[model samples]
Target: MIYKVIQINFFMKGIDRGLNNSVVVLLIIQI
Candidate 1:
């Protein structure tokens, strides 16, 4: 559950930063 929260936090941050879709996907995949 904590890991899931972390992933969501990162996802939100990536969107807030306007990161590329592929980069966000990669980040999620990496996590």
Candidate 2:
């Protein structure tokens, strides 16, 4: 169970990073 939670957290972090990257790209385009 602990391992599963850790895996989920890692997956979520990756998703967050992807979203942040996309937002940065959009902001750069707008500028």
Candidate that would win on TM-score? 1
Candidate 2 per-residue lDDT, tens place, 1-31, comes to 8876776676567677775777556544644
Q: Tens digit of lDDT per residue, candidate 1, span 1-31?
A: 8988988897998899999988988987877
For each candidate in turn, the TM-score is 0.68, 0.54
lDDT of 2: 0.63
Local distance difference test, per candidate? 0.87, 0.63
Q: Which segments of model 2 are wrong by more than 4 Å? A: 19-31
In model 2, pairs of residues that clash are: none
Number of the top lDDT candidate? 1
